[model samples]
Target: MKIVADLRDRFGVEPILRVLGVAPSTFYDWLAREAEPGERELLDRGLLTEIVDVHDRSGATYGSPRVHATLRRRGIRVGRKRIERLMRAHGLQGAFLRRGWRGGSTKQNPKATPAPDLVDRDFTAPGPNRLWVADATRIVCGDGVLWMAAVRDVFSNRIVGWKTSDRCNTDLVLGAW
Candidate 1:
């Protein structure tokens, strides 16, 4: 239909419509249709603008579920599927945080001697402060990456000390102790 309309002046509407397998009367009816936007389409345009605004304000980290929730909070009544369709239509996407491998290798080092196991898989201790377990992890935050060290008393199964820093080093472990 669109091709026939665009090429009507150049090659004539009859030939174009015949080539495109569209009848002349059908094309004429479509061309003579109302030019005004439908009510539902107008409402969708407004809703999409609001959705884009919310998505932008969230740093593009909000998916349809979150976007729908935000819209509901603002007193906008809409379904999750509708929001998803609008987002997909406009090529709007959300940022996803992925968890990568951060554990030690399974294979042991040939040159390094293995340290003696103090706990020997025994996590319980007689009392607090008797046996403490420590570990460190890296957290990705909005500002930057942060290093965290935590010390837990095995007996109480509670964290006794903790420390955080921008850099992961021996001092972080020492501070947690």
Candidate 2:
């Protein structure tokens, strides 16, 4: 909004962005659509309606890439980046990102309890039962998540104790016990 107001007021983008703590490169990206045909560049009411059409036909899951592809297939020839900028200006966006595996933290906390770097980092133990280890992991099914608790006998490398439950309450661990 600030950038748009700045561009509208002075016919320049860089200075306003600088005054408002935005980078010049971002303003330049917004200006990339300046090369489009005048009518298409404006993304007026009719074009905006069409953009919404394209966006919705995709179940609202299409970002500019898929939206542009859909438009191109329908005989519209707009750059993907241009579509992106127009979408931003109009406050239209695709669905939020789909959940995925949470990235593991990488910061080595000097104060964090340090695992003895087991297997000497080998990650491979020669014999089972030699290294009894236990762990609890979670799995998500239709309705809710289930916690799986297990103890592996390092000597025979066999699961000696195992339990699964929808809850990880003490009872669940006791059940495994």
Candidate 3:
């Protein structure tokens, strides 16, 4: 629309519209919208103000879900998805609170000492055998779960060795090495 408005004076409206493949009615509608925003846009602006207010009232902790609930309780007819879109567009976010906490399956024992980061965040090695990283993970099969361990050479960026077992233990990792 801005392009058409700018070039219409030089090329004429119909020619510009023809080249741009925009219908005359569509161009006029865009002009009307620029003069006065559509109803939905006005509603969105008003709703954004209310959303900001609600977020402030909650110490900026109320996300779209909570804001939508509050607005509904106060007799406002609004959709949760619409509230979500507005909140997201305005960069409003809520603090993440996990509903349930379950420990990971591969958690290291507290008594065990963690392996030193020998690579120091650098994976590049001068030679193939100089740096070999190893990792192990559990995989589920048709019958049951299996543990897989792998050793990769940093220089070659290839798997040097790998092994799979029904049980995850030191033997499985050592077998890969």
Q: State each model's CA lDDT, in order.
A: 0.88, 0.71, 0.89
lDDT tens per residue, model 3, 1-177:
899999888999899999888899999999999899989999999999988989888878788899999998888889999999999998998867577646355766999988798879898999869999998987866567889999999999899999999988899999999
Expressed as tens digits, the lDDT of each residue in 1-177 for candidate 2 is 444655656666656666778877775665665545466456555667788998877666677888888888889887887788878998788867448735432356888997675666444467765665676777866566789888777667688888999877677666665
Question: With candidate 1 superimposed using the best TM-score fit, by how many Å does residue 21's alpha carbon deviate from the native?
Answer: 21
RMSD of each: 6.9, 11.5, 17.8
TM-score order of candidates, top first = 1, 3, 2
Query: Mind giving the per-residue lDDT tens digits that candidate 1 earns over 68-144?
Result: 99999999999999999999999998877568754642456899988789889888888778999999998878777
Reference-based lDDT, residue 120, model 2: 67
After superposing candidate 2 on the true structure, give the runs of residues whose Cα lies further than 4 Å from its correct spot: 1-63, 69-76, 94-109, 127-177
Give residue 12's error in model 2 in angstroms: 36
Cα TM-score of candidate 1: 0.55
The best candidate by lDDT is 3
Ranking by lDDT: 3, 1, 2
lDDT score for residue 51 of model 1: 97
Q: List the residue pairs that clash in candidate 2.
A: 128-154, 128-155, 128-156, 129-154, 129-155, 129-156, 130-154, 130-155
